[model samples]
Target: MTELMRTTSATLSRLWTGSARHLTDDELTAVATGETVAQRTLAHLDQCQRCASSLVHAADAIDLLQEEASASFDKAYTTERHQAQRRRIGRRLATLVGTESPGKVIHFPFSGRPLPQLSARSGHWIAVASAASLVIGVSAGQLLHFHAAPAKPISSDGVAVTESAQTVPLTFDMTGTVKLPLLGDGLQHPAGEWSSLTLEEFDELMGNPAFFGNDDLALTNFLMSEFGSIDALTPHVSDLPVNIQ
Candidate 1:
């Protein structure tokens, strides 16, 4: 009977030592929040001063976190803040649409008839037809205005002259394919031969009188039109600085 009593006491001592271990942080948190924890953890917290102090700290931390969360939630969901945000959005939208004032409504006159809607295929075909028509129009214009090469005239020196010294057209025609040469066939003769010519021949050699007169008139008109007068375009002696020696 004494040996059996000693064996029972040893088993009880082993169980007590195992259950007396310190509580974990999770167990302490569960206990602080009133969540169901192991009975051994509760018993340990009641006796162990260190575990009790840790549990108090954990409970205080949880309370602080809960208070902060509640304050943040209340501030975020306040009616006044939401209303102010809505007012700002409305003002921005009003400014974007050029109203510059909130609560202003714009109404358009609606026709009784529904607007015509084109299908994707129909729209594509219309675009294609427009592009084809443009291409055909341009091609036709080029073909109609196409010109053959001008016949070259042979000069007295047997050199083929491509152009004649003639008065330029009053109105420039861009549609024409032919361009008049800037230096005409008049340069075919040597410079020495010009001095030997008669006054009548020299006059003929210097192109038409209309070409020179037209150039002078064009220059004068351009200066007057651009500057309001030739005096404004060309600086006078009085307008120049007197720094020169």
Candidate 2:
């Protein structure tokens, strides 16, 4: 370190001289020892402002170096400080644990377990799926109940309840007309009026004089003659009786 300082001193001296030529060894020694120098060297130094400024800067730098050296923390001081800190920490730890200071770091044995985390989007999908499943289950149950229900019996003439909540039966074809019996036989219903007692109400309706007049007698004769003709042609079971008179 002293060698480096000497080298810097020389370079600064040359800059102050304003020339590359170095100072004589005697002149350098005189300056170092603070002895009176030659009249020529003294005159030179007096005339050189650069050399004067350089010397003043060098003096300030030396003073800063002395202060730093005085303030330095040595290895022994550092070790002692660290040891004091450790003791203080241990005392605090001991107070907390109600135990003597172990003078060393303690190792814990806690196990590290990982659990699954659900993000906002994943949680939304799960909720949606659960709701959908519930709806599907309810719909399936309703469908099964509908399939297992018994058929409702149809009442012949009274208001009838049907699958579509209508009085009429549901049918695909609408092209043909249906014929229903509105008359009744004598045993089941009186000949003059409509009755619930008859299985054949259409026959009783046709026998009524208010509705049929003489047309029923003419229809009976026509039916008998047509049967006679059909029987003569087929030569089948005994001929239809001819008692139309």
Candidate 3:
């Protein structure tokens, strides 16, 4: 009977020693929270200072971790979301407005109408030229009508002087008659040997030769002129038959 009682006591001690080992973190958390846990585990905590200290340490560590995470999240939110808002917005807007997509062609937004493309210096020169031309035109217009207006006759003082006229007969006298030379034949002759040649003689020299020579059109023309001159020089016979050939 004493041996059997010793065996039963040994079994009970083994069960008591193993009860704490079997307890889970949930049961320990319950104990740490001051809530009820497994009956055996609660009893072990009440007696074993080691298990109770471990449970308190786990709970405190969990609380410390939670507080640290919360603080870190708040710091990050303040820095990123509020403090950098303007800068972030500026950067985003710059990227959106200035950045071009790949393979996109740039368009000239202001090219709907043609703008005068004069350079600054060229525009200045053109303005100067226009002004100078205008001035020159105006000056020329003024100069064209610059003639002085006719002066008004001055008023004369009263005068007693009288003018008289005398009548006289006028006699006219004639000078000797002048005759002009015929056409231009009387002018200075051309250079060379034909200086004294008459009109008819000068004509024969320009004609072709006679006989085995070519027909002389110039000679025929001279002969015709000689006949005409002879006719003109002949004096017509009057009824008195004066023989004035």
Candidate 4:
């Protein structure tokens, strides 16, 4: 016989003797091919009482075991599907109830609405610039107001009055011999040597032009007799003096 025929016969014999552990449906079908080797093996088994009885028993046992396992798996699958359906229905009911209640509506600020108000509002940079401009305008206005106004002039009435010009003279008594400028003469004199001066001489030596009106030399001689030395008559000629020469 061929090797395939030998192998098929050996496998069929093992199944009949119950020595074969198990055979998948494909293996069993392959051994049951409508070939002469499989037909001969079946004919042999039917004639032999022991092998035929064992084959019948094995087939019955395998069918019963497969039927039991299939029923159990179907029951478990049905139970799991029912449980999943119940959970899904419960979640749907919860969602419906929450939507029907008076709950606060939560919307994403940037996603849901058109944001008309925010879009109309000024941006941060624009707001800052506006505030800065307002401050700058106010500061500029204050500076302009301060600078536009004129300053008040000082009054000359107090110093320009002729009556207020009369004043006491200042004299420095030198301890040692010192040469001093003469009152009427155009030269200096020795210290402690008195030289009487008039108001004109006092004004000329003091560099005040308002003293001698027209003839400064004539006024100098007249002022020399009226006043003492140049230093003594200096105080009498001022904007405002309490004492006179």
* Top model number, lDDT: 1
lDDT of each: 0.59, 0.52, 0.52, 0.52
Residue-wise C-alpha lDDT for candidate 1, range 153-240, written one tens digit per residue: 4434322332222122223333322222232236774421211333444345445656445544354345355543442333222221
Residue-by-residue lDDT tens digits, candidate 3, 57-144: 9889888998999999898788657758977777777768876333446679986679877899998999999999999999988787
Name the regions of candidate 1 deviating beyond 4 angstroms: 1-17, 79-139, 147-160, 164-245
Global Cα RMSD, each model = 18.4, 23.6, 31.0, 23.1
Clashing pairs in 2: 182-201, 182-202, 183-200, 183-201, 183-202, 183-203, 183-204, 184-200, 184-201, 184-204
**Tens digits of per-residue lDDT for model 2, 75-139:** 34687798999989889988789787455665455434455678999999999999999999999
Worst 10 residues of 1 by lDDT: 236-245
> In model 4, which regions exceed 4 Å deviation?
1-37, 79-245
RMSD of 2: 23.6
By summed lDDT, which 10 consecutive residues of candidate 3 come out lowest? 236-245
Q: What is the lDDT of residue 231 in candidate 3?
A: 30
What clash count goes with each model? Answer: 0, 10, 0, 12
